[model samples]
Target: MPIYSSDSDSYDVSSSSTRLFQRERPLHSILGGGRVADVLLWRKKNVSAAILLGLTVIWCLFEVFEYQFLTLLCHIAITVLLFIFIWTNGASLLNRSPPKIPEIILSASAFKQVAVTFHAELNRSLIVLYDIACGKDLTLFLLAIASLWILSVVGTYFSSLNLMYLGFVAIGTIPALYERYEHEVDYLAGKSNRDLRKLYKKFDSKVLNKIPRGPIKQKKSK
Candidate 1:
């Protein structure tokens, strides 16, 4: 449809005109991305930190010989720590890379493999850190054996019996110990995977940057 304008400059009052009108109009509606992931991430860290703090306090009490509540507090503390560490690191490590077309086209197995790989690496890193820190506690088991030996040789055979018994005792701590080990492994895995994911995200051409939703125009400084 041809529309005539009497003015010197003619504007095509069609699709182009509608576009110009849209360009001039300001957005009254709010724009936002979903915060579900971000909120969950924050909760992951905060809850983990809170758990760790509480566990530390309980362990301190346990060390002070608070026998009345030692076993309960100690086990609970370790359990909570275990869960928190796994969650905090897991959430961070699991990167949402833009889907790869070939992989999706060829097989879903490729996507499954990607998830497995990310999890494996994160778990490995967490274990390494856990092993290093808990090593000292593990050493206590060895030291207990040594102390028991010296007691048997120098003192009466039964005099240091209780202390010697504790040498074999930390065997009870093994599960909690391993739990810590696993926690650290997860952390390490996540950290390493996250770094690798970041590198991949930066280099991958398919992952395009989103543009601002508005007309582009050159602005001059006043």
Candidate 2:
């Protein structure tokens, strides 16, 4: 028998089980089930912390300090080149072997594969957008419109860099927190979903169904 933990509103099961929004898959599997998931979930705590720290420093440099990316890149390159130049000269004077830099090459096939994948994904997104615009699915169309409206509202408040940093922070923290308290999160999510559905039904019956409509022409089978 497996041990079960219970809270006032949520129950945790220590076994393979489906949860809301997880689509019958484990959280780790849903997150790609590899090093990426490990880092996101804090399985590699040091790596995750280091990545967050690095991102925070970059965000601070760009947003708080107003550093331009190209200027920073050139400064970094100059510093690195200067250090290497001095090291090589000092090594020659000391009769020591200079640093051996590995050659970096861009593979054509890898680039082609990436381009092809990007093209396919872009086409797929365009198709979805077209369908939504065409009103192929009313619910999906409404959802897309609502999402865009929310994004636009958010954009009014935050700059692009601020939004990006907030998104990065959310990505770094939300998944680990969800995995830790998934039972409670899923329970609350399910409850909220049910409530939303009930509200939608009420609105549909009261408002949408009350709207005047023309007679629908049924498609005839040939």
Write down the lDDT of every candidate, Cα atoms only.
0.48, 0.82
Q: How would you encode candidate 2's per-residue C-alpha lDDT over 126-185 as one tens digit per residue?
A: 996898999986655777899999999999999999999899999999999998888666
Candidate 2 segments whose C-alpha is farther than 4 A from its true place: 1-18, 92-97, 102-141, 217-222
TM-score between candidate 1 and the true structure:
0.17
Error of 2 at 106 (Å): 6.1
C-alpha RMSD by candidate, in order: 29.7, 4.6
Query: Which 10-residue window of candidate 1 scores lowest in summed lDDT?
Result: 25-34
Per-residue lDDT of 29-128 in model 1, one digit per residue for the tens?
1111223222222334565445445555655455445544657767889997887677666765776343223656678796788788679868986875
* lDDT, model 1, position 148: 69
lDDT of 2 at 170: 94
Location of the lowest summed lDDT over 10 successive residues in candidate 2:
7-16
- For each candidate, give its TM-score against the true structure: 0.17, 0.74
